[model samples]
Target: MHASVKMQFDAIANDYDRQRKQLIPCFDEFYGMAVSLVECEPSSKVLDLGSGTGLFAGLVMQKYPDIHLTLMDLSDSMLDGARARFSRTDRVQYIVGDYSEYAFSGQYDAVISSLSIHHLTHPDKQRLFHTVYRLLRSGGIFVNADQVQGHTPAADAYYRKQWLEAIHRSGLTQEAIDSSIERRKLDINATLSDQIGWLEAAGFTDVDCMYKYLDFAVFYGKKA
Candidate 1:
């Protein structure tokens, strides 16, 4: 599963950024909410997990240019795209590794992820929330802008149906759509309630879903 994710993302690295707007039905509001919740000092250290193509990090940089941003992903090709997106600067660093298992060295002011994490199994996702809690400084925030399963089997099916309908009419090429569907085979989304419980169990405070549009949602919490 890990190797498959790496290979598939590497194959689409070059076009990942361009296709995001079409792939996500609520691209603007989704990202806008995520970035807005990333409140921290201007020069604080921020870590982005599964930071493919650095799209979310770039937006965060726009908001806080002096921030020390670390982008980690399983796919080096995706980080290559990130390297091109940002200028050569000491403020940005890229690492090619699995976010779920990496032994990160220090704490951060804020930890964020986008369109990733759903690829992990439910247990992995819960473990990751605990990891994020431990990695955060006091009062630090964690925000995840990713997909989730619906409350029930029928609702989950409906969410998938709606997403498919939206994406089909979203103007992406057939090849791109097909590739996305193939990549989605790796998704193991947890329900919103389960995720909130995981966050709370991980020692996060003020835990809440800041926004939700179908399966795409922005979850936010802060370390106390």
Candidate 2:
């Protein structure tokens, strides 16, 4: 599963950022909410878990220019794009490995992920929540801008239908759309409620889903 996911993302590494907005109907608000919740000092350290192409981390950098960011991803090709994205600066670091199993050193003021954690299995997702909690300093935050499963079978179907219809009309080429769909097959999204519960179980306080539009949601929590 990991190999297939790596290959698919590697194939689209160069074009991933270009297709993001069109593929995500609520692109602006979804990411905007995530960035706004990354409360920290300007010089704080942050880890962008599953930070494919460093897209989310880039937005955070724009908001806090002096922040030190560590971008970790399973795909080296994806990290290659991130390397170029932050090439002008020496404040960023890259790690090519599975974040779920990586033995990261030190702690961070904030840990954020975007459109990446959904690819993990349910158990792995829960374990990662605990890892993120352990990696943060007290009062640090965790913001996840990613997909979710619906509350019910019918709702899940509706969300999928709406997403499919929107992307089909978004003017992407047939090949691009097809590739996007193939990549989505790797997604193993948790329900919004379950995700919130897992965060709480991982010792995150004030856990909540701050924003949601269809299956896409931004989850926020802080270490106390």
Candidate 3:
């Protein structure tokens, strides 16, 4: 990713929370759905993938004071925002790199990625799931808050148009929307059910959807 590309997120980082307040209900649902599955305690060591602006990470950090966290992202600018958000917290370790290719070090008690995996190509999402499965200790869990592709043709078209309009209404510029949709080459999104099947195919056990609202969902699976 180009430096400037990451800078786009950095520019919006400070206002990101305020501007995206409209989505708070959705994110709160995401967080609640995630935590219900993987309970955090003092011993939990969490890996937060594509942790933009560190919103979810901040919540986890605050809720579990003793929990250790590894925050990873491909964007330097986003990492900068994450660092500032959790200032004075030695419990967090930061890494700047593409998580899909970068080597994930250390076994995590739980691994979670929020709202970023949809940006990946289908094959990349599979590779990422396999990598996460590998990184987990036996019985450890993996959960993701992600956007799913609708299964039916009609539903897919409906959700696509709805999502685009939601972004437009929420104040994103037309150019940014077009550029982001194009730059990432997000041509097809897999249904939530299909994503869970991939996790099961990766040898993860007990994979299932934790929550769903339209095309947005949180899914979790446990390592055997």
Candidate 3 lDDT tens digits, 1-224: 33444555556566555545444336667777776676655768999998887777777766687888899887767777888888887888899877878976789988888777776778888998999999998889898877788889899778767766776776666665665455434334688878988999888998998898777788989998
The C-alpha RMSD in Å for every predicted model, in order, reads 0.8, 0.7, 3.0
Query: Tens digit of lDDT per residue, candidate 1, span 115-203?
Result: 88998988999999999999999999999999999998998889889888888999998999999999999888988999999999999
Highest TM-score scorer: 2
Candidate 2 regions exceeding 4 Å error are none
Question: Global CA lDDT of candidate 1, please?
Answer: 0.94
Worst 10 residues of 1 by lDDT: 84-93
What is the lDDT for 36 in model 3? 65
RMSD of candidate 2 to the truth, in angstroms, is 0.7
Question: Which structure is stronger by TM-score: 1 or 2?
Answer: 2
Residue 16, model 2, lDDT: 90
lDDT of 1 at 63: 97
Clash totals for all models, in order? 0, 0, 0
Question: In angstroms, how far off is 166's CA in candidate 3?
Answer: 4.3
